[model samples]
Each structure stands twice: as structure tokens, then as C-alpha cells.
Target: MKKESKVFGIYPVIEALKANKTLDKLYVQKDIQNPKIQSIINDAETLSITINEVPIEKLNRLTKGNHQGIVAIISPISFPPFEDTVETILATKETPLFVVLDQISDVRNFGAILRTAECTGVDAVIIQKKGGAPVSGDTVKTSAGAIFNIPICKVDHIKDAIFYLQGSGITTVAATEKSGSYLYDLDLKKPLALIMGSEGRGISKSVLSIVDKSASIPLLGTINSLNVSVACGTFLYEVIRQRNH
Candidate 1:
């Protein structure tokens, strides 16, 4: 019932954009004709923010006050500068590990993954600015405060982060059943990044294309897939196991 994470009205939304606020998404009134709305649309598109055009009723429900047909959801946590985070981790840690989340949208799964990453000694988490789960209060609760313990880097695209990691001599591996290899077969002791995709779609083809390797968790039962966060824990602990030996 808290609207603290939202900014309503045209002027406030516009100012939020201008201030470079960490925005998760934008909602505009459908078929509304206004020059300001068009300008906000253009700015949101340029920033790669997810935009939804909803009916006036939906906008009204989001806010009791006049919304002027716009509502912007503010992210709960600030994302660190991607390159600076990566560089600092590389400099400070020997055999640093990273978890690159490719659009993991479920808040519970995302929070659980953060907890696993922190427990498994992952140096940082990389996520896309638009497609991934919004860092909300539920995320904080589910993470059990681990969200504050780990550094998160948000990039424009998942593939770009993978490319940067590879350039920095970090091996990039993706978790997907489409791969022929198993997780146990990989040498994870080196500085590396593990990429996990969304719950329904798994990894996108474009992202999977650039990863240095791909591995799958063995499924012995009829179920072919594991929950994204559960799968992520399995993967991270494997890396920890390999490194410990």
C-alpha cells in the first residue's frame, strides 16, 4: 500500500528522468494526446526503460492524486557503475566469481539467487537494467539482507557484460539444458562468471552465443528443469566445490 516506490504525474516523472533516477518502469495513459507525454515517451525509450500504456483507470488506481497519465516505478536499490564494479572486483579478488542474471524477473527467485551468490563467495552480480526483476521490498525480505552484502551491476544488455567479462580474462559460462556438457565437467576454479536466464525462457540465444561455455544440471527424474534460484545455487556451489579442492 506504499506508493513510495512510484512517482506519479507528468512533471514529477519527467523530473525523475532528468535526475537520472533509478527507474524500473514507466506507465503512460493510452491514447492520450499531449506533447509532454510524447517527450517523456521519447526519454524513456532512450533510456531503455520498460513502458506500459494503460487505461486511465489503471493510472488512477496506482495513485489517488492526479497522475497526468504517467507513473514511474523507482527501483529500491541503487545499481553500482558496471565497469567500476567489475574492475574493482578483478583487482581485489584472486579468482573472482560473478553471477550474470539474464532477465530473471521473479522477485523471490532473484532474491534467493542473491543470497546464494553471497554465501558462495560470488564477487558481484550483473543484471540488465530493464528485463530483470525490480529490486523491491520483497526482494530485500527474501534476500534476508544479502542484497546489501553483494554488489549489483546493471548493464544495457546481458551479452555486453559477458563480452566485457571475457575481455577481462574471466571465463563466462551459462546454465542451460540445451548444452551438451554437465556442470560437474567444467573447470570452475578460474576467475569466471555464471549466467542464469529467466524461469520460463531460460537463456536467450543471443546471450548464450557469447558465453565461453555452457553447462546443465543433471536431472534424473521426470522433471526437466529446476527453479531458477535453486538451479543457481546448484551451479554456484559447484564452482565453490571446484575452487576448494
Candidate 2:
């Protein structure tokens, strides 16, 4: 993490939020009750940022100095609005590719997927503002600096993003084991968006119904499923393969 990226203590964080700074995430000490801190929580929620109430020791480990109960991690990159980004990409690329992440909060997995998304030339990555992984140091490092290169779009909800994409003449594809159709069966040559979920609860039932195609990565072994990042990489490369041929 860069030295100037984080603000320690409650007042600093609260002021940062009031100033409308782009905050990636916020961590507060569990069970601490103060009116000012409550204000911070309200502001963070209003901005749709992910918040965690961790042990005080966790906050202490984040910095050598005193934390005063709250710490705000500033994002190095600013995310574009989901609607504007979609409109811009649709205007340019003939067969634009977008990646939609559903409740995938693991920073490492999110970072790795960003790397693959960048490699595959994805126009932008769409993630839910609240439950998705925060743009933190760990995520940035795991992405191998791809976070800086790729356009990240923050949306109010994953469903809204999907609906908007489909409305704009983009096909939405979901990767989940519940589907019988293999990834190769899907036609990705057209403008499309790929939706990937967390390892815990694949894709939401509502989201599954909205996707244009439900695809699965064929697994030969006994393993039930593949890691989210690995599955995303496999599907992205398959799109490349189909477009080239």
C-alpha cells in the first residue's frame, strides 16, 4: 500500500467520507459505540463501500501508529460509473467483452481475475459496490498492476448491471456448474458480458434466470468445480479462440 493511501483514526476517516473521497474500504473496531463513528458507518454505506468490523488488533497491525478505532483505505484508482462505461464500450468495440462479478469479495481471487480480464482485453470489469472485493493493496498487488490498467465499473447491484447490459444489446453469460451447456457451446463472438460468482454461492437464482446463456467448464476429474479466477480465465480464452477461428 502506498503511504499516503490510508487515513487513520475516526475523525480523519469521517472527514474523508464527508469530503466524498474515493474510499476502497473501511475497517472499524468491533463493538465500539460512538456517535461520530456511527456517522462514518452511515456515510460509508451511503457510498456503497464495503465495511468490516475487525478486532482492534487487526487495525493495529495495519499501521504502526494509533488507529483511534477507524481506518479508511483510499483507492488508487477511481471506478467509472457502470452506465457510462457500458455506453462508451458499446460505442467502440464491435464485439466488446465485459466481466461482471457477483458477490466475489475475496481480494486475491478478484485480483487474479483482473489480471486475466486485462490479458483478455476486457472492455471493463463490473462489480457490485457493496459485497465485492475492495480495491486495496493486496488486490492491487495480486493483480500484478493490472488494476491500474483496466477500467473498473462500480454498480449499485449486479442485477442492475445485467439488466442494463442486456438492454444495450449485450448478451449476458453466467458460468456455473448447474448448467449442462459447456463453455465451448456458447457463442461469444458477439458483444457480451460474462458473469462469475464467488466460490460460496455460485450465481444467485435471480441472476441465473436473467443471463442469456448458462455455461459450465467441463471438468474431467472428480472435483466439483474450479476456482472462480481459473474458471474465468478458461472462459475468456475460449472467447479469444472462437473469435480468432
Candidate 3:
């Protein structure tokens, strides 16, 4: 998908809906009570497109041009529901390996991480509806089309997702510098959901409180931290290594 193909305006998105175009996701301004907007929302819901309520600033940043408080991401591939993806993983009888991204806003970083996750056989990629990278054309390009292959779930809150995963018997692990245990020490052979946070801010405090195990990659160099995408690769491969053994 190219940059121009990603539609980000209220009218454009509504038109897409009217035309029955396949959309990856849709972002609507929070607290919008307008009847017309509600009609659009209703139409989108009828089509079963993933819709999220976000702040107006997020919509502006997605497109500097007039977005009219709405943005729709058109994707070549349709996204699956979070529950369905989880169920599919379990049905296949494979250890559920999922990735939860906390507020990772950069498109390139998001795409790169998706590429790594796809290569590592991750079942699904979970991200918050707000404060995360918009699934734009650049992200698709950066992932080298891996985004189409991988199932990405946009949730209302990461904490809620963690709770759901825990309820489903999946162990949740947070990869952060604050962790005392090293990544290599964790047993990743079981059903697992690996959480990676944003570049500027680490994992959110609420999310950190819920993770079952917290582990970190041992840094050998003087650098205090690793790039978010690189760190994701390391953590994912560690899971692969452990599962193989």
C-alpha cells in the first residue's frame, strides 16, 4: 500500500464505507455525539471494521490536512478479532506466542517489529487503540508486507488485554530495563505474551503492574537502552530459542 492510498478524512472514510472498500481500521474522535458521525460509526460497525475512539490531536497528527475528526486506515488485508486470533492459536495446538506493544508510536519501528514478530512465528500483535503507531502506508512498506500476514489487534486498553490473556491461561511477560531477571532466564516454552513498550516512555505503569514476569535483555555496551524494534527482535528470538530447546 502506498502513502496516498491510506484515507484519513471523515468524508473519504465514509465514502469508502459506502463503496464497500476493505479497511484495516478506523479511528473516531472520542466524545463525538454528532448524529452524522454516529451514522458513519454505525455503518462501520455494520461492516465489522475495527473502530477506536481517540483524542482529536491523534487524528490531526495522522493527517495534517483536514481530517474532520476522523481517520480510516485502508489495508489490503482484513484484521481478525483478538479473541478469534487467540482461539486459532490454541486450536492449532501450538504454544500461543503473542506480542503486546505499549504506545510504540513510530511507524517504522512498528513495521520493523511486525516483521520480526512474523518471522518468529508470533500468533498475534496486540496494540492499544490510542497512543500507538497509525497503521499507515509507511508501516506496511517498512514491514515489507509482513503486516498483511500477521494478525494485529487494536485494543481499548493494554491492561485489559493483559487481564484477558491471563484469564485465558497465557503468561504475560514485560521486557523492560527495570526487570531484575535477564531475558535468557525466562522459560518461554509455555503459552506467552511478550510486551514491548514505547521508545520515549517504557511500559505504562498500569501495564507493568499486571505483567506476570518482567525480564530484560542484558546490555553489553555502554548504551543505556536499545531501539524498540531491535529489542523486540532480541526478545522474540529468545522465545524461539527457548521453545526450540
The candidate scoring highest on TM-score is: 2
Q: Is candidate 2 or candidate 3 better by lDDT?
A: 2
lDDT of each: 0.89, 0.89, 0.86
Residues 1-245 of candidate 1: C-alpha lDDT, one tens digit per residue: 22228899989998899898878788899999999999999999887787888899999998898898899988767778899999998899889999999999999999999998999988999988776787777788888888888999888888888999999999999999989999999999999999999999999999888889999999999999999999999999999888888
Off by over 4 Å in 3: 1-4, 8-10, 20-72
Q: Tell how far residue 210 is off in model 1, in angstroms.
A: 1.9
Score residue 90 of candidate 3 by CA lDDT.
80
Error of 1 at 204 (Å): 1.1
TM-scores of the models, in the given order?
0.89, 0.93, 0.80
Question: For model 2, which pairs clash?
Answer: none
Q: Report model 1's TM-score to 2 decimal places.
A: 0.89
Show pairs that collide, candidate 1. Answer: none
lDDT for position 103 in model 3: 91
Kindly report which residue stretches of model 2 are placed more than 4 angstroms away from their true locations once superposed.
1-4
lDDT of 3 by residue, 1-245 (tens): 44425677667877888787777678889998778778888988777666889999898888788877788887655556788778877889558899999999898999999999999999899987666877777888889989888899877789998999999899999989999999988889999999999999989888999999999989889988999999999999988888887
lDDT of 2 at 42: 90
- Candidate 2, after superposition: displacement of residue 142 in Å? 1.5
